[model samples]
Target: MSAVLASVAGAALNIGTNPLAIAGLVPIVAAGLTFLRYLRFDPEDHPVSVQKLLPEYDFVIIGGGSAGAVVASRLSEIANWTVLLLEAGPDENEVTDVPSLLGYLQLSNMDWMYQTSPPTDSQYCLAMIGDRCNWPRGKVLGGSSVLNAMVYARGNKRDYDAWEAQGNPGWSYKDILPYFRKSEDNRNPYLARTDYHNSGGYLTVQEVPWRTPLAVAFLQAGKELGYDVRDCNGEKQTGFMITQTTMRRGHRCSTAKAFLRPVRHRENLHIALNSQATKIIIDRRTKRALGVKFVRSGRNKVVRAKREVILSAGAIGSPQLLMLSGIGPKEHLESLNIPVISDLKVGYNLQDHVGLGGFTFIIDDPITFTRNRYQSINVVMEYLLREKGPMTSQGVEGLAFVNTKYAPKDGLWPDVQFHFAASSINSDSDQIRKITGMRDSVYNTVYKPLGDAETWSLLPLLLRPKSTGRISLKSSNPFVYPDINPNYFTHKEDILTLIEGIRIGLNVSDTPSFKRFNSRPHKMPFPSCEQYEFDTDEYWECSIRHFTFTIYHPTSTCKMGPENDGDAVVNPRLKIYGLENLRVIDASIMPNIVSGNTNAPVIMIGEKGADLIKEDWLGQHFRKT
Candidate 1:
């Protein structure tokens, strides 16, 4: 016999070894190889480090996050200028590079690990710890991008036109489209390269090279329901399509990798990891930002900014940092005993997509991700070699934006979004626990047995919530976490809208394409919502209240508006009012939440904000000449 056969036969012929025993070793060997590949792999070429201090830089960007990475990279293109990027977490390791491993990172050290304040009587997030939903924001260099589902969605054109109407000049759909196009590098040959998409840019936008059969069925179901199969990021978003991801060759192409890694060797740029900004150094007399005071290696250090300080620390961090720096509501600051500076509404307008998650469908076909070990081994090797397989799916395989009855007939934006996941949220045992932050008791009682079933799920997302919320200072100390109160479902209309969305999601399953799978509703009632009958409107309303949770797209805490608008914190150019040499350049500056995932829009904001800053300085230089 050959050497391979000889070894196998020798093992099988051992004193107590049966044929079944030898077969089991094959799977064990394959699993061991998968684990080794996951641990030894990393995609980043240049991971930055914290270097010695610089006395000054022309520009200082706080939070080496999604937008900050882009801003620092763009600003440093000028060889004469020096830029500094401060981040609170260390670099991403092998664990963060594999896209499917995203679930495991939330509880890791790279997460900020925030949670919403407990609801008063709504019973929202009842399944989570202490009745508060876990909010995991990435603390690493790429920030939330490293932790997000990696879907690339740009909101409808009318969303931007409304921004212009709200006193933000030059921000209409026509003006901002170029910036969006300028940032995308579309790699999917299947998608039509038109005015809506560009082929050469920094960020890679492509369809997942591999997808589950259920995801393909979802697209067919959309067509069966008489909806157009169109690109969501294209002219219309009313239909369903495979999601384009912020990934390159099956790995996450975070802003840190796309923007920062390629430019880290630039002589004038410096990155500081594990450095948290405690305060913005503002000269009280002149109302000008001078530098920043931060905590690094357990020692406080101050660094100067010669020109301007840009805040791209995201919605929660940006607004909280402003409040800590004495730049929020006067009464709240007084309550905390912090001296008041600019009394801007730093954290008043919190918004996020509230999703209702109980809608699931049991399918007769075993087409989901819950297969046996041999099939999983094939998927692992496929991804390892060709960068293709179910491993490329971003959990969310398809997205649909549609106007519910709540939206105006002529309104240009959709109020509800449906996210299609190929696998059942409850069917994945350890994954559901990590993704949802459910208590052990809740997980064991409600979701553990689901592992034995084959199912798919659709999450109805409230894109335009009538209710608004806020963030507040938990303590004046910068190290203390901020108190986030999304105040979900505060308005009764929100609950009603989501109920309509759930009805729509159910209606989609009645189509011929879905019927082929022998689909049936999996009606699992919540303990808190059991008072109402199954599938009734009352039951769904109760379910909406009980299971309502965020999709992690919070924005508008430092809202942009005209100069004299009372609620405005930043101006049309994103400059903070009553402050000189300072601006906020992240999603927090959005006047209102966009209609889709906020990552693509935030990257566009970084592109436009850099142009605005450069334009202003160039104007000053020309005037002097």
Candidate 2:
């Protein structure tokens, strides 16, 4: 065996790699080599074919991100068509493949590292970075999928139904289900036979092997609270279940790895890394998107597209690019001296899942990912060889979706999502200090005391908020980060809804299943809540304001609706209104944010959008013939 193979085998041997174990190593080793080669033999090392040679293409998809990767890969399958994918960052490395290291990736080199503008009118994130929350969008090839905690959640059916009701014709629940199934390769046998899932597809959805005992207790607690143990993403969403992750063979199945990597050998598909798209090449006279202008290695290059220029740069990047190309709100573009092409509301209606980060429960036993025992060399070996153990676990393992009493009585969809995380006490505070750019004084005062305690945290995420925010230009410069204001809790109803969510969670923790482990609320009293009694509604309200941070699901900035809908930027077909041959195919096009983690839904969007594009062009070609 080669030295590298021998070393890997040695780790497996230590764990007693039986015949079955040895067989599993083959694919793992192959994927590793494939990933390594993709990184090492970058297009930059060769001739500038990715740049100069592809000056004109049948299609140009900017951003090799979650949606961008899928669109480019699917479109290039036509074989006759040439596609160019431009990414602003480097390729995905080994670090991004490990699920446990997801937290550290935020604000790292692979992250966009955008921070929301400090709350102007609300104190929702007062304890965070300069009173602003860290907004970590992925800068790597797979985009946020490489950076996100890989929970595979397809939002409730009603979410898409609501979109179709709002004049988007082909976006009803039934309409999108086929696309969701098209991209999913469900590995869990329990879900495989279910009508909601499909196997033999690109994205692998499976239950992680290693799960904390406390997480199991959380599920049990859900049962005791009268909630059924249903597949949260299956027929019903209102129940507790262990989160399904986007992983395969204990490695992250990022869109780049799942969808893009396998198809990299296709000659028609070209990828350019470290190439930042500075502006979309829009024809001012005709308002047609012709191609893109990008900067790579400090040189400006233009690539034209004969067919279409699709923007999959995500919620923040897509809108910023559009406004930079002068295809946004007229007054805003005029302020920056960017002459308007289509006076559309490109950067309005920003929405996100704002999660309450302070609520935690201290348990008696030390059964958590951060406990020292699980961080040993043996555990690492188990993961390297068998694709099992703590390293495979996406940190927040147990998840529950519930409707608060405040939810509309007639509505079947859940309004709140609860994520149960097994933590070695104060993990959030430690993470904030180490990764989220928070101050030591705040960490010491607010989070230090709980460091050694065995704890499990329950974060209540508001799925739908009446309050909306926006992304606006900091300057005319494309590189300058836009001002992100989630404007969390601007509506009093949002805070009231979360207060009910907290009460419901505390009720679940009080259940006999959780009580067996001596689970009780971790009391880190915030000084801001001193006026109210501990555990009371007023106190929890204060706590929510101080501790609420982003669950990172941002959408609807490039709103999708019929042209008559005043706020709509993209039509039902996802084409930018008044602009020919250009489409926005990312989270930004959501008429409203989905009711769960946005990653899975976003991938489905990519799959659905690619089909629409294919249907449109292929039909046209057939007609011409």
Cand. 2 Cα-lDDT: 0.82
**Could you give candidate 2's per-residue lDDT for residues 66-138 as a string of tens digits?**
8998898889889999999989988887668877667667878898988889888777777665877788898
Off by over 4 Å in 2: 1-52, 425-430, 620-625
- Candidate 1 weakest lDDT stretch, 10 residues: 15-24
What value does the lDDT take at residue 235 in candidate 2? Answer: 84
Q: Model 2, 178: alpha-carbon shift in Å?
A: 0.2
Question: For residue 407, what is the lDDT in candidate 1?
Answer: 79
lDDT tens digits, residue span 388-434, model 1: 77656667888888677897686446788888886766544665676
Model 2 residue 223 CA deviation (Å) reads 1.2
In candidate 1, position 454 carries an lDDT of 77
The candidate that wins on lDDT is 2
TM-score of each: 0.92, 0.92
Q: Which pairs of residues collide in model 1?
A: none
Candidate 2 global Cα RMSD: 5.2
